[model samples]
Target: MTITIPTGDLVGVLSDVVNFAHPKPDGGVLNCVRLNWDGEYLHATATDRIRAGISTWHKDDEPDDDGQDDLFSNWGGADNPWSILMPLDDAKDVISNYKLGPKEYRVPLTIDLHQGVLKIERSRDTGHSRLVMQIQGVLEEFPDVREILANNDRVKPVTGQLYTAKFLADFAKVRARGPLQLAFAEGLTHITIGKRFVGAIAPLPEDRAAA
Candidate 1:
């Protein structure tokens, strides 16, 4: 089955989540960006256990005239969501190509998933060349990051707590559309970047934070 995502939206989602993805050698499944489609919104998420990043893209209508194959049917039912894990390198490549490629050549990317392999195609108008790339999807199951993302509670505010500076700084890489806000509490530090991206970073123990 195949689905189309807007060029700018793809780049935005990738940029927001890529930094949170861990390296393949160390993190295995955590080194991927999970792409989920629920018949409306397409979400991209990644985490390195300590911190996470998430972004969403909405599709109102199908872009291709042929209609292609139904993503839901290929998986199960419309109510059941479909997801695949893309490598961190592929996510970075997409972002880099979009930024460095000719502006006029930028077009919506078509994602084709089949038989354990995932393919992405970017086609240019008329005389321009098309770019197609394929890579294997990681078969390992991704951790339940939703559980971590939902535990953010700032009700009992705290101060002077220690957090890893590197984790806090990853939020800045999100390229948020609006102001980035951080809500500190006793446990996790909730991060909100614009309206579409959200994340959380675990606080470090004072002993470890000082090192």
Candidate 2:
């Protein structure tokens, strides 16, 4: 199982818009995840107040069993940056573990908060890809993400009930009139659906005067 992508690229894309909010009654953990950019791609998933998911990243090195002690301090690229934490699992239950570079795979990872980089020790086994990211030292201890996942209330039968309810209600409101046309442009995909404003919809061909 191998999936390799650019760390910097991944972080940059996800960072711009990764806002998953939890509004469950017993939803534990009031803290937000500040995904620490450590020159590695760490996939993560969480339900704002319902079901959950997980993802993995290609760190320079696989984190030790303890999963503490960041290697960023020793990495030293620049000053410092804000850290985003997401409740994610190691290659264990999250996404499939991936190869790193050509001619080598299956290496350990070390996270350095002080240096803002993930350390990897290359091995001569599988052909993996190498990715690099410019990260700064991540100050402040990252909140323990596992604590929320371990919560007993999380396993309740009514997980994501609120989300489900809202989605279903919204779905029913969709107009039977079919999909509405929005607009088109270069490097873009425009899709419109279920919006019911009399003026927002363009007139049908018969209603137009474009002789």
Choose the strongest candidate by lDDT: 1
lDDT of 2 by residue, 1-211 (tens): 1223332323322332122324332434422234443343443333333322222344343322223322322322322332434332321111223333322222322233333433322222222344222233233454343343433222222111112345223223322223544332221212233232111111223324333
RMSD of each: 6.1, 17.9
TM-score of 2: 0.27
What TM-score would every model get versus the actual structure? 0.79, 0.27
Which one wins on TM-score? 1
- Model 2 segments more than 4 A misplaced: 1-17, 21-54, 58-114, 117-133, 157-160, 163-211
**Candidate 1 wrongly placed segments (more than 4 Å):** 60-80, 100-106, 152-154, 208-211
On residues 46-116, what C-alpha lDDT tens digit does candidate 1 reach at each position? 99888887887766422222233333322211434567888888778877775433343224577766776
The per-residue C-alpha lDDT of model 2 at residue 135 equals: 35
Superposed by TM-score, candidate 1 places the C-alpha of residue 42 at a distance from the truth, in angstroms, of 1.2
